[model samples]
Target: MSRKRGKSGRRAAPRRSQASTRRSPVGANAAPAGRAANRSRILLMIVGAAVLLTGAVAYRVFAGTSPATSSSATLLASTAGQAQGETVDGISCQTSEQVVYHIHAELMVFVAGESRVIPEGIGIVGCFYWLHSHTRDGIIHIESPVDRIYSLGNYFDIWKQPLSTTQVGPATGAVNAYVNGVRFSGDPRSIPLTPHAIIQLNVSSEVPAHTFTFPPGL
Candidate 1:
């Protein structure tokens, strides 16, 4: 068929279809859209990886099972010296000299109107010091070649636990140390480990224990 012509006798150009118009621009712009989508996917992957790593770290910390922590605990325990149902540090408490002096002391703890049992192993570790405890009965045995002043804090240090004016283990609050049936008005840590000394560390109890009877032969 003959093409239509304008009045100047030139043929008119073919008009573009709606589908072609839509597709041409979309195709031209496709590269940027694809690049944006890829960037978004990479960002999402990075975020997910970071979240997973953080959660793993948090779990390890919460569980107290981190390698560093475990290794440190093992090192400390080994250093503290534990063997044959006994724990002691590198320091040697045993001496070839005869026991020139011997003394006994008692320890008692009260928490919230309840008697807390002191464990048997105070001063047994890191070289049972010149002073030691054999039983939970709170009898601290000061057996040494020479008599020397020792403090309740010294014993606790060998035991490796927190004992201060404000706290004892899980118990928190004011603490009082009584010696020989009298309330000691100084730092509980400073209570002297005198012979036949009756030391009572009371937590949250203002009134000290009246008496701590020593066992026979203590």
Candidate 2:
């Protein structure tokens, strides 16, 4: 094909377009490098703050705290000594609600159908609870959260407590339960336990049960 020239009548082929620009390696890597730098800076800040806090706590423990105060603090904060069955049994026996001790040397609790986030709202209303009436081995045993709400007969509907005092209190030991902090049943520690029931061998406060034992940490 004949080419046309714009000025002075000189024939010329059309000018080729310049090659499309390519990104330089340095430029291409800049974004990721910037992101990595930002991430590193954040990590360093977190680690530094953690180190500082840990150092401060260590100083308080070793230097600022006096011996007597330290002992009291340790006992209150659970650092001085393990409770009855904590270390020798290889588990934490002490816990608030939502945690429990098990007979198999482990931590335990029950939740219905989920990991216990708002477990009471689930379908556990009439579920059968099978905890022993007496401790089988240790100091304290646990009953079902289900039973705590269900077993009170018509009174439960009127009283509105998850567990009655008599139900949760110890059947036979020093760790008898109290309803609203009052001894609910006969103090298990008293000399005259129900006939055919009290045995010195089973007078422990926390008892590890066997049947229906949930696996440790469950």
Candidate 3:
């Protein structure tokens, strides 16, 4: 009877060992699953970072507010005060901006394939000119007391900058002009500043014209 009890005890010990061996695979499999989950999370983080970077670049290009544009704005604004309260090309500066015949036009200038900013306060100092700019996004506000034909040359005269086939602002090269996405054959200075006109000037290198959507009530 004693021998039989000892043999039963040895048999129970082997059963416990078998149960422990079966649980070992569960722990081994769980380690691999945990590692896979961590890798997936890392991959998702990398992809998300790439997407955010791409979005920022697209917004900068579309809004035309890159670093270069800001620098150009500052440079142009520095000299804009020189023609304050002066009559330029029959356009007079008034104590306040007139909007009786209010209109807006957009001008885009590219030099060597780079876009330049048309600064704000083009005809403003202590007063406002009929042809003036209120922003640095290349918008020219035509706020006149009387309705009449206004030309791009008139605006440039107010800006006190040179505009010709061989010159634009300070850039000198063969000038190419576009009006409302159409190639303009006349002298670039003669391009009319019609209501909602989209004018583009490229110096040296030619660039395809781009259209701008005016803000509401512009």
TM-score for each candidate, following the candidate numbering? 0.53, 0.23, 0.67
**Worst lDDT window (10 residues) for model 3?**
65-74
Ranking by TM-score: 3, 1, 2
**Which digits, one per residue and each the tens of the lDDT, describe model 2 over residues 1-218?**
76777698988766555544666789899999999999999999999999999988875654321222222221111111212222211212223322222221111111111110111111112221121112112112332222232122221112121223233111222333222223335532232211122121112243322122222342
Model 2 Cα shift for residue 141 (angstroms): 52
CA-lDDT, candidates in order: 0.63, 0.29, 0.80
Give a tens-digit lDDT track for model 3, residues 1-218: 33333555653333466666576777779989999999999999999999999999876665663222444433423444357776877889989888789899998888887787787788887889898887777888999999987999988888888889998888889999999999999789899889999999888899988888676688
lDDT of 3 at 149: 76
Question: How do the residues 1-218 of candidate 1 rate in per-residue lDDT, one tens digit apiece?
Answer: 99999999999989998777675777788999999999999999999999999999975664342122222221111114223223233323553322667788877666665665555555554355566667545577777666576677766666556678987655777988778877789778788888788777778866545565454565
Q: Give, for candidate 2, the lowest lDDT window spanning 10 residues.
A: 113-122
Residue 197 of model 1 has an lDDT of: 87
